[model samples]
Target: MGAVRKRSSADRPPSSDRGRRIRRSERVPDESGGTGMRRPIWTALAGFLLLAGCAGGEAASDGQGRPDYGEIKSMVKDILQTEDGKKAIQETIKNDAVKQELLFNQEEIKRAVVQALTSEQGKKTLRTTLEEPKWAATVAKAMQKENERLLRALMKDPEYQAMLLDVMKGPDFEKMLLDLMKSPPYRKQMQQAIQDAFESPLMQEKLYAMIEKAVESALKPGQKEKGGEKEKGGEKSEEGGEGGGK
Candidate 1:
């Protein structure tokens, strides 16, 4: 009123300023909830969305992604079902080196077999089997046939027979026989056998027959006349001695 003020811009608030302040205050009310509680809820919701996005990104990556087990299994199954894969497996097992190793271990296998057969249980089983009549008979028959066949084959070999004869005729064999006969035990056995034979009744009868034949032969011809003269002389001497005594 004093200066009839021209109402310059600096003397009063602009109408636009009032409108802006009112809009700001209204916007703040809309953003905030009762006691401003919606602030934390909105912040937590934003953080959860950020983490979900990161997890989704990681799941989509190639190297760090989850494994596709079904795909891997299918691939493995396909490879194993192929002909080449089967052939490779078979060749590994049937390799020449494996065959050679088995061949080289044959002696070890034989030793293992001998050890097993020589064990106490094995001996007991063998004894039981041999004690069984049927089993023993069968084994004996087989062994006998084998022995007979071997003997026949050996007898058919002329070289073997010659070797046997040579051995029998060797000086070593003659020395062995002479040594046996010279042994004191052998001499005693032979003497006992001879004495037993001479003590037999048939030997005594034969000896008596031989003695009677010898006496008959000695008494023949001039030998019998000389025997009768000696007997008559002996009887005269006996009669002379008896008369002198009377």
Candidate 2:
């Protein structure tokens, strides 16, 4: 008889299996002999609450068959704290519709900002905040790095460099510079620098060396005169000896 051919696993039909796998969205059989359909968490939660009179019984509620605001808030908070709920919220926020809904017009934003800044309470708050030394220092410290980076970028820009040159060459800027140099604070700072130099050990050593060099220079001419006179005396003695021999 001819050999019977066996069908390979890969050649077999997909539906030939006896067992069926359950899909995530498919209905699951419950122990109560009923099928449990997959539903959204919020929908299931709302359904459960409605079935249980919102919050257990009438006594647990606001004397009504509905949950109180506090209970509802706590329930919502608990749901929001869950990973699934957070992921859902994040997905909802990332939706195009949500972005369009949240976005405000530029004119509206500008008007709101102007109103806020111009308001009496806002001005007072700003003035008080600025008047605080600690707050001012903290804000300056935070902005220092950003300001330096911005300045560095501006310095590299040709337009910014031209603008800076224009400002620097202006009479107002020159006056400001001169006024700063002539200020009492500037004089005091100069004095402090001089005092520091005088107090420095290196400066003191340099000064001492300078004084020794000056003294050596002052005494050098006297030594040179004596040496010249001794040379002349030796020359005269040599001449006298030559004449005596003659």
Candidate 3:
């Protein structure tokens, strides 16, 4: 008879050295995980696999004394679906190391998001969503405060100031202003503003004072105009050259 062939790494069951190591770790602490959580989970898995593989190692063997991968996967899935599995997952997530790992992945998530938004499919989806008036309105309302804050911050930026000045100084802006000024609505608004100004008591007093000053100024100009009598009825003053009062 041929010598009994020694088992290779590929022939060994998952419950071999792995199962024993898992069992050993359960008695000690797992500093990396903040608790011995990983050990217990692994120990449970190893014990299950050991049961299926240890008896002559033939019952759950894929072909020759090795546990089947498909069976292992199905078993893991069934285990994960249990309530205890969910609780274990939640506890594991509470670990500081896990939180740091999640935070560290944020930059990658951001890049993925940007790439998605820039893609054609994402653009089409965005356009469809925005076309819904209710959605558009809700988004606008939600973003209003943020938009205002961003604008306020931008207003303080020197680059933004320069860009705004450049735009206002452009020929297109000048044309736009001229067109706005020429519009009937703009003329109507201007007339309405003038009427409102006249109706205001302060504006009325200011206008009245301006008119009185203008009258006095006109009279002074007239008095200094000619050295001889200019009015129909003239009285020449010997003290100084002056125009006759109208």
Candidate 4:
């Protein structure tokens, strides 16, 4: 076998050396050089960060912006002033269910009113108002009208008339009347009424005629007996006197 010749550095394969050099040169640099193939990635990352920062700034600005309360209030006022809004509110209030609820709560409302009026302060206020002459007069006139209306209504009710008649005919009512008649004040009033009636000329003439008739009736029989006795006594007395003279 022939002795192999020593391989020299210059005799090394060009392909292997070239491949190693190419690999070394192809290694990505770190911060020492511009990104070559990664340029688009870096650019994309940078652009994303910038956009994020812009978005953060916009959010910060939105957070710092205050609401326009005055404008909001104006808008609300305008809405309320609209005809549709008014109609909606009116319709809600005029609902049949609302009316029924109000009717059902009427007793509660009346109780509340009675409770309030019965309170000391309410009573005092009412008294003060009623003490005013104008208020009192107005109340009196209203009460008079109410009483007249009630009287008219009662007069038109046959049942009410029957009830009244029954009450008047009742023993309790008779007792009440008898008690009133027995009272001293009632007796005085009745006597005064009688005296007033007798003061009339017609009553006085009737009374005088009744007394004259009563007196004539009482004296007629006695007058006849007395006349007969007087005639007999006078005749006897004449006869006695003639005898005495002889």
Question: What lDDT tens digits, residue by residue, belong to model 3 across residues 44-93?
Answer: 99999888668646544546556578998999999899999999899999
CA lDDT of each candidate?
Answer: 0.88, 0.85, 0.85, 0.91
List candidate 3 segments past 4 Å from native: 1-113, 124-135, 192-201, 223-228, 231-246
| Per-model TM values vs. the true structure | 0.23, 0.32, 0.41, 0.33
**Where does model 2 exceed 4 Å of error?**
1-59, 63-128, 192-246
Query: What would you estimate as the lDDT of candidate 3?
Result: 0.85
* lDDT tens digits by residue: candidate 1, 1-246: 645566664587889989999888876655436537777889999999999999888777954567789999999889889999899878876999988987999999999889878999988888988999999999988799788999899988999999989998999999998999999999999999989988999998998999999888876966769999999999999999999999
Backbone clashes in each candidate structure, one number apiece?
0, 0, 0, 0
Q: What's the CA error at residue 123 for candidate 3, in Å?
A: 3.3
State in Å the error of residue 117, model 1.
14
Better of 3 and 4 by TM-score: 3
Candidate 4: give the clashing pairs.
Answer: none
- Please rank every candidate by TM-score, starting with the best: 3, 4, 2, 1
Cα displacement (Å) at residue 206, model 4: 1.8
Give per-residue CA lDDT, model 2, range 1-246, as digits (tens).
Answer: 122334465465566252344353245666555444444566889888898884566556555656478988999999999999999999999999887776856678788888988999989988999899999999999999999999999999999999999999999999999999899999899899999999999999999999999999999999999999999999999999999999
Task: Please report the TM-score between candidate 2 and the true structure.
Answer: 0.32
Best by lDDT: 4
